[model samples]
Target chain A: MMKKSDLYIFAILIIVCVLKLVQIGYSRINFSTDILLNSFKKNYGEHIALKKDIIEAKKLLIENEITNFNLSEELMSNGYFKQRIVEFSYPIRLNETSKAVISLRNKSNTCKLKSKLNDLKLYEC
Target chain B: MNVKSTHHQDSKLLIICLLISSAIFLNYFFWAINALSFLKYVNFSILIFLISYFLVSREFKKYNFIKLFFLSLLILCLGSALTDWDARSVWLFHAKRIYIDNDLYGGFDNYMPELMNAYPLIAPSLSATLAKLIGHWNEIFPKSTNILLVLPAVLIQCFFLKDSKFKLMWLMFILLFSGRILINGRTDGLVAIYFVSCCLVIFKLFIGKNLNFLSIKNKKINRSIILVLGILFGIILTLLKNEGFVIMFIIFISTIFFKLLTKRNFSFEDLFFWIFIFLPIIIWKFMATTGGVYPRIIGFGIEAVYSESLTQRIIIRLTDLDNYKLILDYLILNEKFIISLIIFGFAFLKNFKKNEMIFKFVIFNSIIYYFLLYFIYLSTPHDISWHLNSSAHRVLISIVLLLTYFSILSFQGKKN
Candidate 1:
């Protein structure tokens, strides 16, 4: 026959087991806001500037300094937008190289944006 | 003459108890918020109290509760300190991966899929659940989570030791003090508990011929309970780790071997018990194999280039003595060795007659299982060393269970 003491011990053990299960269950419902923020920062932060670069590259290509441009392919491959541009001032005096200057400015602008985005805190979205 | 000795002992016990309580309280108070969730820490405290209560009040009535409590605390403290170095970053972090994704099958993207899936789901699943609930799956949570996993086994151990006439208090003290238990929280501890429970149930049911099936006695009900408990224990073992199934298989085979060797008539009830114990394991194996949870071996076939390469790697690693030494050190020094010794001692000393038969069968089966795995590891193509190291604890679950059973059986004999 099962003794009363044995039953009590069993009951206590069962209660302990139930308590553990409940505690574990309770902990599962809570989400870590910090982890979510960190994940968002890691995944999304790197792509932000690459997105802006495509836009700037598109504007520069439309201004007609660079030629033989395919924006869709460029955007797909290098995050740079492609567009046709006519230019004649290369290998000449600084004053006449307005189109070249515009292309240089666009390239630098994209590069600067990329670097700035890279500088953002990894865990900051 | 009696009052003075009693008064002195009571004061000594009170002091020891106070010290243990303070130490545990302080330890928990400091780490409770940062490492462990509030509920988990509290639960752990409750568990310790329960263990102390059982051991001091009933099992070893001669021993003062306070002294045993202190000894347990010291053991835990030492074990934790010794094994605390790299586990936080390795196993505990891996557990966090399970929690974050909430898919035990979804392999850790950072590690190889095979390597990631090598670990059983129970420990990680529990950690994941805790992480999910706590809102922060930090390193501390998983490490501290080991306490819960170890509790059932420890409690069952107490039950096993209850009737033991030996200085079980000292044995408990030694087991607790053993450093391995403190170091890492893994699934092997649970496996040990399950194995011990299985033995206890088996012992309770089949120990003496006094409880025969043909007799109009409680034997029938008892046998049914044993069958149910054995099956439940086996399923729990299988779920905890893949090696758990191996242990169950060994136990089952051992039982059959024992019956056959002894010339015991196998009846429907015996068959039913075996079926009950083994059905879940077989079903699980089928599911695991079919589900592609583990790689399946078909008929003997020629090895591919990749398979050949893996075989070479496994061979080289196995041949390296240094690697084996490192693994042995890691496993033995950690809580497993002490626990195993105590269980083995108890089993060898107490369960000498029929119980020993079961123990020997189990030991034989375990040896075979271990050797088979070793041979397979020797032929594996990848860094089997890394895989083995990671899953080492899981492998020891059976041994732990066997020892636990022995310990329990030893104590159970004391009652008679």
Candidate 2:
């Protein structure tokens, strides 16, 4: 019942879908580290992790591949505004090229993490 | 066609639907102007608009597909967490600031200079409206507004695509193009939808005869109604994104050429109406520039362009095959672009003789848009490759959609 051209078109579509899925999978693996860094940087002050221990929380983030964390919402609801620069060590191997440096300034209320990735070389924050 | 006199009620209905969508978008812009003083009022108004949109979407004869589109859109929005840096750093962050401070420029300190805080506020204002309605900002509601803003354009498209085959093709196109970026609170996808829809509307008004409701022999009342709707869409298209202005300009300028080629004069009244609608954007830009919030383009300085290093940078980027290869890789990785090219090829073959002028207009616009993109890349002072890597694909998404939409319009359907 199927025409040869129809079969060919179907095959091409399947191939395209497969290629897209593989591409997405590859990007997820690659950007996982950056995503983790961003979560920490965004929620540094307003999250529950800030009230307990900043360095330990960041350590968890750096080690794990967690993409979504609401630590800030919990911390803010509990009445704590994190306003200190909490520095911790992270493996350069975690993200070979990208480096995230998060500094939570007390006076500025601005938590910024500078992340730059170019060549596949390890760097420190 | 026997001197068509009666109105095409379906076309009028389509125009009303588009107007409702434009009204909602413009409501956002209105809030942005006096956002601080009228914060609560704007939020309340936006609530009303959303409710109205839900009720009005049912007014269409075939509302099932639109409902499915929204349902799928909701699923897509909730499925993914917002991890895109641009979404968090710029768009959603701006929305959160508006929600907290109840003003457009709420958290100015958080705005990086490069984020273009002064860019038109349609996307951010709508996001803020959604956050206000939900009573809090967690990410999902604010980002969902992207799909909400595009819903009207989708509805207008559904009207044109009455055939089952065309409907299926459109659904396939939507699924293919609605990848992570579209639902992830990005303006690029919103911009693409608005620009393509605006072009399609313009084409229908000027060159195509499908909008039989808007025939020239209609009463003066109908003519004025068409003029007002055309002006409103043109303005909304310009306000959608900076590139939107360029796209609309290309369309407008090419309209003149196409009209002349066809031995007809481009309507001066339409041009005047479009400019009148565009006055708000000019005023917005003037205010931003005067307020010193807008960052001046670094590469625009003559001294910079003539600088030996800058010239070398431009030359290197222009001559590099690797840069072209990077774009190709991005396109190839996404099946949407390949399919768009294939559809365009088929459409061109089918409509080559029938709609040559409009077909040429579409191709001309695309070639010019591509060249403008390349020039921007060459002139940008940022890390050229990084800039392209991050944005080239996003912008190309718009172009591919534009081409696909044009092909759909050009294809000789039974209705056409």
Candidate 3:
């Protein structure tokens, strides 16, 4: 009961959707490969790769014992980094006077090295 | 979905669609009020969807391709990580706050200027409810709510297009205009698609042909149901985003314009309904101001119009050719808008007289929204270039949708 043109149009749409599925497959593969690479490199202080903030925040939350922490002025000023890390790292409030400070490795706080991801470091001062 | 379905069937399909719309909205409402347990909310939503699915089982069979299409879309959307700025920083952030605190207002303190500014919470609330269902947050699960919210809007249109070809074209255009936003987890796509669906409701109630009135009781029930659905959509639209309220206002003004132009009888009850629906947003604004929600976008959205310094800036920006170029880059040079224009132009060439009324209404709404966009950009409090760079393309999606939608209707001739 369908027209020839209708079938063709539907076929074309199906093809387009198939292409989207393929795109999704390719993206997820890339995402998984990056996570695998991050885990493999995490011991050697290698890259955090794409959405590195997410990985870093989750790592800190899982690894840290602190209830509150502070970001160094440099990290605090970068709006994108601050917002993403803060949003991802919930129940770990960012307090100015907290003993735990998240800082760049070279700008370490005078405390124990709690955790580090790429250049981002968690220090309990 | 079949051409053989009678007008009676079409009316029933629409009523079913409206009920589905109401169900999608309750995902947020039931969660916001905490009137239903999380388990209850999930089960209730599934139950409503099942009942609606069975009620229109015949059309569902004919339209099974759309079901598969949405499945493909959901799978694709679910696989992506949330990297978009608004998704993470604004919407999902609010969702996280609500999830952790189990209340909405505790996180309203001024934090990041971009993050703390109170945007609407419908998308976030839905996403939060979803995250609660899974008992944790992830980059993927929260954004799935965005994709799911797009369903009723898309389903409502199946009854609007008169034939399979037009409906197929509609599906294709969804990809062309909204595919990226659908995956990226923003309210812009929701607003664009939902706004068009709302406009269709407006057209049906006001401008288009009469419904299958049948018995007097059936007529009253049908009309009342349609009116209530419109109000529900109006409330949902205003709560979606600040721009949503503007889109709702344009629908109001455009319908009034059409009524005046056609010398149609205007109903005071409809006027009162618009006022009643806007109560939620008015209360929201009052809360934002009184509850220490500082520096709302009221600065750029409205206050900029009359602020002495801001008006001068707008004038200065208006004179800059590069400003015009930047806006045109997003609004005109974009591929989708150009396609919309070509389609609309072709439709006008073919059947200008037949679709004149609808065309006029669409164009009037389109023009008002366009000017408002241009003015908002000119008066923006953020870096104008940054604001335009970030949002101009998203805002223009509605216009692209409107033009192409009317073009599809135009191709159906005046019979629909």
Candidate 4:
């Protein structure tokens, strides 16, 4: 029921639409990639800061007995950690000899305490 | 020959397109913004409608030039980021707030008094809805929504030209496509396209041919279609911007005057249909007024008109040749106005006396628009020079489209 010319016209339209789709997809990908990169850099900086706080907390525990101890409370009060970390890690009572080793893990191991080595420092894995 | 009822079909399609865009806008207002849910599924449905509306429509697919041109414009729009200050600071900024908050009222943070948060939500609603659908806000896709708003009017214009000579069609294409506003993510072009198309539909349906009561069996169907289309366009015209509402009022008044002279009658159904179409704006205004979101603009009041400085302001503006010089330079240097003038001259010469009443309506509508612009400039709340210099050209787009449309109709011969 359609003419050859109509078919040609439709083909041209389809081709143009494909080109448009490619353009949109390509631009969006580039934009999203840039944003993701920036956010990753920001998150990496936060991890570094969290490591510093853990180091400070370890030193405090080594020096004196902490009566009211909440690692998240200390870190958060210092304005470095976001809310998600509060629920992940729980408060622990430490002896003077025992060292707290803080390391960053994948999302699944976010607040879990991994194997403690001889070093009393914090590690971000 | 096939274009006999082309204008009728064009009106219907234009209304359908605007209504869809309006639906998207209102969906954000009443539903998406409140739920705090992105309504990604609804947005997906809209995308399907957008693609199929053009790609699958037999009328559109047959017009290769228009189809390719429209798709290319969409591609260009999507590829570009939001760069215009008004686009970035005013339009898309509003969209960002609404999209993030998912609350229409909370979106008012970006709507500062001087920045005009008082403007309507239709354009921002579309952009915000696009961002919601995408689940993240990027500068490009949301602005690309302008193309979606523009496509319907452009396609309807193309349909109106379906039977014209190829050369004429190309000319119309070049003229309409040359505007920078179309690509720059501004609502001015959208307003211009819709308002001009609204006027065209009105003229075609009322003043031209459909007047003979005895000839057609489908008259009732045709009248019902126009009534529905008018109400749809009326709703959109008002919601697009404040100026849009004024233009719609002018059209309403002018059409009623013409109808009275012609002794055309309407049923109670027509009145109710109009009331239904206008209900959205009525509710919107009620919210705005009761909530004190925006102060009522009292431009028409006797108090404002008879203010002590009216004469002083008028004399001062008129005496300043700089204002005339700036307006002249702006109009002359603008490509849209030049093309519009040429086409109007050609149409006036070719169809000198044919469709005189229609041309009168065109001229009347144009004068009312320009007069309002001139009056606003004269009594502006901002610096007059800056106000006129910045906006005169953008506002002229509606008039240019009006003249060009009538010129095209003239070129198509008097049979329409």
Q: What's the iRMSD of model 3?
A: 7.1
Listed in order, each prediction's TM-score against the native is 0.50, 0.70, 0.86, 0.68
- Regions of model 4 farther than 4 Å from truth: A1-125, B1-40, B57-60, B107-111, B164-178, B211-223, B266-270, B295-312, B319-321, B331-335
**Candidate 3 — which residues are off by over 4 angstroms?**
A16-54, A97-99, A110-118, B1-12, B34-44, B47-59, B212-221, B294-308
Name the runs in model 1 displaced over 4 angstroms.
A1-125, B1-115, B164-183, B203-226, B265-359, B382-416
DockQ of 1: 0.02
Cα lDDT tens digits, model 1, A1-125, are 66887667646544543443333223421223332244223122212222444334434433433432322222223311221111111111122222222332223322122112221200101
Alpha-carbon local distance difference test for all models: 0.44, 0.57, 0.70, 0.57
Sort all candidates by DockQ, best to worst.
Answer: 3, 2, 4, 1
Model 3 per-residue lDDT tens digits across residues B349-393 = 887777677777788888999898878888776667788789888
lDDT of 2 by residue, A1-125 (tens): 66787667656654554454344334531223333333223332233212334444444445544222222223323322122111112111112123332222221213233221221111123
- Give, for candidate 4 chain B, the lowest lDDT window spanning 10 residues: B296-305
Candidate 1 residue-wise lDDT at B313: 56
- lDDT rank order: 3, 4, 2, 1
Q: Give the CAPRI rating of model 3.
A: acceptable
Q: Top model by DockQ, which number? A: 3
Native contact fraction of candidate 1? 0.00
DockQ of each: 0.02, 0.06, 0.24, 0.03
Error of 1 at B366 (Å): 4.0
